[model samples]
Target: MLVLLLLWTGCGSAVPPELAPDLILHNAKIITVDPDFRVVEAAAIKGSRFLAVGSNDHVLNLAGSQTSLVDLEGRTAIPGLIDSHIHALHFGWHITKHVNFSTGERLTVESMVARIGEWAKNVPPGKWIYARGPYSLDFVAEGRLPNRWEVDAVTPENPFFMNMQGHVGVVNSYAMRLAGVTKRTPDPEGGKFVRDPKTGELTGIVYEFPAMNPFRGLIPRHSLEDNLNAVRKANEVFNSLGITSVVNLAMPQWEFAVLRQLWRDEGLTVRWTAMLRADARVFLNKPYSEVEAEMRALGPPTRFGNDWLKINGIKIVLDGFVEAAYMREPYLEDIFGKGWRGILLWDRESLKSALRAAGKYGIQVAIHVTGDAAVDVALEVMDEVDREYPVAGRRWSLEHAGVMPTEENLEIAERLKVIISTQQSMGWSIGKTFKKWWGPEMGGIFAPNKTWLQALGHPYLKAGSDNRPINPFIGFWAYLARKDVDGEVAKPEEALGREDTLRLYTSNAAYGIFEEKERGSIEAGKLADLVVLSEDIMSVPEDQVREIKPVMTVVGGKIVFQQGS
Candidate 1:
């Protein structure tokens, strides 16, 4: 026992004799989220890393004069939550700087217009009016996006642009005129300018990123201070929710730079894994290759940056959510017509070229795939690349694998060793609407968490909030209940147990960002990223999971947030 104690205490080695754990938490349930999913009594942290995890007695022995002991009082502790896919930059900008349409009551066109008008009143004239999100198509009375004329009528003098959660955008006439976009202006490749069917007049509703860019570029960029504040505010939200780490879905280069600056200034509070976006006209003014060259020249390869900020991979939006996921089956007849299969944002050759380039650079690629057809194309390209470039170590992932990943596709995903990162929380908000739109057969499989879990298990399968409805608890509830907001069970058999669901947000998410060894679980020598919950989420009544809140959030062994303190 003396020898064991000596070795554990760093005795007869490099110990300075005075070194001891800075903090310790004991007398509570600690969900380790290890391979065995052990639940221990206590944990000790030395500096930024976990010192030991065992019984309260064992961990207490590691404590010294400087140790700050915390009696958990039977509260439950788990690994700090990891949001696998969130738009931290956009989410921050929306929450801090833009007019948030999600905060108030049900948003009709009048209400939306009223909100915009109210916001317009506060800003100086001629300053571009920008609103980031309020992306619910169901909220509008017409079941369509807000019209340009409605925005024109409200914010007539100011050039206005509202980005609707990546689906589409509404731009006022002033904004359009500023961008020189008129009825005669040709629709850019990979996007559309929504026009009236009869009159051919531009409807002011822009579809996809490429098309929205012309007008969206007219908006003035936020000041650096605004950017910093936005990140800080977003970090607070994450800390409050027990999220210590996030894989930002598509952060701009400028925002990434801001985060790096924050890290240098000791302002970054959360671990950020950025999936750099190569969207045309937004961040990249040149072709994809030029952008790739710049990124390669910029020092860090995938996962090369520090603990706080790392560039994980590149984000390629293969298709839009609605009307453009490249489906195998013809979409059920809609305005586009019968046999209207969706469109792919990039052609097969172009996508292959991009994948090859990423592989050459040794950077990982995260392709946004929604349709099964898109998945099929992705698999083919990956298979081809594997034969040539051999991406076994790259950890390339398919983001938002979409609604229809057939068993064959799942097998291919597994065989090819690509990860499927999806957001099940989408079902809670958009499942019923999609079910009605796509018909039962197609829409029933929205998210398909259970199916993916059954096939890939927790390791290859990763879950994210996607910020569609950013509440992680709501995501937990959705997975457990397997039901949408309207109490409709899309696929009950696909529901997961509480433990598996927890793994989705914890360990699996860590693997998705290629940081599985660094933080995800409660383990010795790992970063002391943990959350103490109001209740044991594992043992709570399945329905009560959403009710449980984080009582404490600890990052790098520092108490970042404490309930009531």
Candidate 2:
């Protein structure tokens, strides 16, 4: 019956001649996220590339006897999803090792300490305990992080470190002592060691990665096999969610090796773009000349490796996130101190010089500028470097421009051709805290999706999940609705149209990694990476967007995931 049906459909008088396809999917709402955003009836794939796309009659004519035909029966098919920014290793390790406290409801001092106490029972005495958080200072009933003494009460023998959203960290006394971080230990450059004002004692709260790295360095990483297994597990999850490509950020050389090995071993199922970190021990604390020489040794600017795993570029953190972000204006209330805006992790001259050095090596740089002030600094740095290099297609990205860029700054970004790789997951998961910390005025303006769309337009603006919730649907829902957990809208005017939001994670994302021409859309000649969804996301009710699931995810014309598989 299948062969008979194909014979009837494939034989058409006056049909244009076409090549045979390895696979044919018919009766689908093929959302070709192309320039015109065309929707077609069917698509045909030949050996990892899209063979033809158009009405069923056109595509079916391309199918041969060997073509594996699939009748979608009116399912929605889209380009396989892309996560523009994620810490794959960190996410993988966390998923395997720790319990998540990102939901806000489970983020109290009592609850965290109790969970730690329970976890300590299994850990050997004097061993390290690490916990990852989506924690905020506002989430706790006390409106502050728990003290070391409080954490100590639960695990006096076991040293513990709670990593809070990559910005702040809480350490028990045992952990502090292990690192020898006494009250006399001076604050590191570009980082703060929170201390009690009255007693001048260490509060055990470490702010910024620079400050936390000393203690963090003491923890032993998982074995190579374990890390690889964790990444495999994470990829399984990513594939299940229709994520075919991810730009994994802040990857040091070692982690990149692991991912490369996974690809070589055929264990990698998702396309990975690893952005090298500048602060790896090899570059950190080194003179500019040394760092430049080291980066130059890494090879050329063009992406290296095959479609599965490739080196994207360099990543650097210029500032913190959330309330710790270095802002031009002070927060609604002074939480750090009087005149406390936030921490500037690099001096203007040093930052400019570092950027120029990276540019000299022809390396694409991705800067973590979570604040508007930091965004300005990053733009200035980019401008300086671009002038020095006089190169086009630099495509340096600004990761997590948390605050909405001013019109003038957006214009600067356009002029510089910088990609705005921001996230909507932050709003969906932490919108309430943003309001409480930054006040209604600034918090409501947090992402400013609509403003960005109007200013920078579609091609330059790409949305990332940041892995807080790790659900792209939540990112989709966040951008479309702009609503908090309470259903209170934050800058409802900034909500994006459904098509624009979809592009944020699709074609624009491909553009971010300079893969726009190769994949990202269900167009003929593009790589056959696509997803079949249970519901049509474009026309679905806004609230129902989050509940939509991928029935199948195909990468390189191979089905990597299917519902119930």
Q: How close is every model to the real structure, measured as TM-score?
A: 0.90, 0.90
Q: Please, what are the lDDT tens digits per residue for candidate 2 over residues 1-565?
A: 3344345565653222244688999999999999999999999888888877899977877666778899999999999999999888877877777655665474667887788789888888988888886545545665667789998998889888988888788898999888999999999875789999999999989888778988999988888998898799889889888899999888888888889788888657799988888764455556788767877875456487779888867888887677677888887777666766877777677676667777787678889987778889888777777777853477888888867777667777878777888788777677777787677877632487677667777788897777766778878888888877667887777778989988999999999898999978998889999999989999989999988999999999999999997
Number of the top-ranking candidate, with lDDT as the measure? 2
What is the per-residue lDDT of model 1 for residues 407-431, given as tens digits with 9 covering 90 to 100?
7787777777788887877776667
TM-score of 1: 0.90
RMSD of 2: 3.7
Write down the worst ten-residue block by lDDT for model 2. 10-19
Distance (Å) between predicted and true CA of 299, model 1? 6.0
Q: Judge candidate 1 against the unseen true structure and give its global Cα lDDT, from 0 to 1.
A: 0.79
